[model samples]
Target chain A: MAKKLALIASKGTLDWAYPPFILASTAAALDYEVCIFFTFYGLTLLKKDISDLKVSPLGNPAMPMPVPMPNFVQMLPGMESMATMMMKQQIADKGVASIEDLRRACLESGVKLIACQMTVDLFDFKRSDFIEGIEIGGAATFFEFAGNSDVSLFI
Target chain B: MDFDKEVDAKNLNCPLPILRCKKGLNDLQANQVLKIMATDPGSVKDFEAFCKQTGHTLLQLDQTDKVFTFYIKKRNDAL
Candidate 1:
């Protein structure tokens, strides 16, 4: 039997979004069966329209800037979008795959995409609002899968 | 210096190089060697972990400047 990996994606920021997707795709390539459970803000990534996925620079000490900016400046209106744009540009410049590309790669590699049913209900998301091939489930379902996984991570 | 196949993963970062190497190795016969050239600095550890996890043979690893070259042999039991 193939090795199993279970991952939880709980954050929606661009930087936060990459770990589960990257790990899942890589684990699939390594012949491990990977399942990613998207909950809370992470459900936004599965939405058909991902334009709202912004990087929160405010209070995010890890957010790298071309020029150092104070926390107060990051709290200014529009700063989050500016930081998001900068991050996107940096990712593009580095030839890294975009979230869309990574998502497609994960699917191609047979990684299972699961969305939190509770979050979907809480956020008023319709099944049709997300990309195809997503399985909707609650924590119980996630625990069942994770129980058999060789590796489980909460990212 | 002999390899049955070569995968150029230059400029690809993180898991991309390892993913490409995994896919490339799938095409080779048992014991056939594959050479992967990558520019990502993290690929050294990534490939090591990949080989360890997948049960492939890491024949040799060499680095010249920024490029990392890994020679791997496919294991027959790898499916």
Candidate 2:
């Protein structure tokens, strides 16, 4: 009776990335057979250069910070990197753990990591760009696996 | 009777109790039972869903006013 869990991860931002990882990790911990499908922007999570993935500060006026800062200041060249670093540090400080940690936990707990084949082809990325132990597949593959699952989520 | 492992998850919500229960289960040997004590009303449904999805056996559920307890046996320890 072990049901499969399919998580559709489609965003690259720190906020967005955490949800899929956290949920999948938690599900796996519960001994639920879980798989995460990384597509489009979400594919950035597996890149060797994780520092490059960023959350856009544009349009959203409510991005929280310890101190009040102008939108223009946040848009500066190095600000995105700074923000990512700060977010990483904050997560660690709060004992919330990192996405890397969650990924490791998920893998250790038998959670499957899948990269979307269509998205990879769309983005023109090679398999070498992904981390080790990740399986590559398409929508049909995921649907076939996920169709019988009791719980399926899009994060 | 086998002694069941207990986890107190007071005031935790959504995924926290379930997360802790999972971690606790992982620490045990196969077929060992874990009893989770939770105040979250959602835990009943959540743990039920968890057992259905994970293939674990949910042996019992006890509710007394504000507290809820679940007895779950770890089934995937071999993995």
Candidate 3:
């Protein structure tokens, strides 16, 4: 039997969203049965329209700035958008696949996606608001999958 | 090294090369070799780990300048 991989995506920032999707897709490519549990802010990525995903630069010290800026300076009104643009530009310049492309790849490669039912209710999100192929489940379901996985990650 | 199929993953970075190689390998019969050429600096370690995890055989790995070439034979029992 193929080894299993379980990933927990708990953040929604543009930068925070990449790791789980990237790793899950790569693990699936390696023939592992992969599953990703999206919870809290991470549920935003599974929304039908992800264009609203933003980067919170105000408190994110790790947000890469083209020009070094202090945390206080990064808190300026327009800094979040500016930082988001810079990050997107850098990702494109590096030829890395876009989030949309990665999502598609993950789906095509058979990486299972699960959205937290508790979060969906907390956020008042309708089932139709999520992209296709998502399973709605809570902690028990995630624990069941994680317990059976050979690799488990929280990203 | 000889291979049944060739995949050009040059100029692609990180997971793209591995993703492309995986897609290419899917079409190959068991024990058939798939060759991948990539320019990503990370591909050497990536392919090694990929083979180890997927149960494929890494037949050859050669590098020239910025290009990295890998030959992988599909595992007969791997899904």
Task: List candidate 2 stretches off by more than 4 Å.
Answer: A48-52, B1-24, B30-79
Best-matching candidate per lDDT: 1
Q: Which sections of candidate 1 miss by over 4 Å?
A: none
Collision pairs in model 1:
none
Task: Kindly report which residue pairs in candidate 3 clash with one another.
Answer: none
Q: Write the per-residue lDDT of candidate 1 for residues A1-155, one digit (tens) a residue.
A: 89999999999888888999898999898899999999999998898977667887788787667788898888899998888888888888896878887888898888999999999999999999899988999999998889999999999
Cα displacement (angstroms), candidate 3, residue A40, comes to: 0.9
Order of models, best TM-score first:
3, 1, 2
TM-score of chain A of 3: 0.94
TM-score of chain B of each: 0.95, 0.90, 0.96
Instruction: For residue A100, give model 3's deviation from the true position in Å.
Output: 1.4
How high is each candidate's interface RMSD, in Å?
1.1, 4.3, 0.8
Write down the C-alpha DockQ for each prediction: 0.66, 0.23, 0.78
Index of the highest-TM-score prediction: 3
What's the TM for model 2?
Answer: 0.70
Docking quality of model 1: it rates as medium
Please write out the lDDT profile of model 3 over residues A67-87, one tens digit for every residue.
778888877788788778877
Ranking by DockQ: 3, 1, 2
Per-residue CA lDDT of model 2 for A102-154, tens digit only, reads 67777777788889988899999998998888899989878877887878988
Question: What are the per-candidate TM-scores when only chain A is compared?
Answer: 0.94, 0.89, 0.94
Candidate 3 residue-wise lDDT, B1-79, digit = tens: 7799999998888799999999999999999999999999988999999888788999999999989999999999856
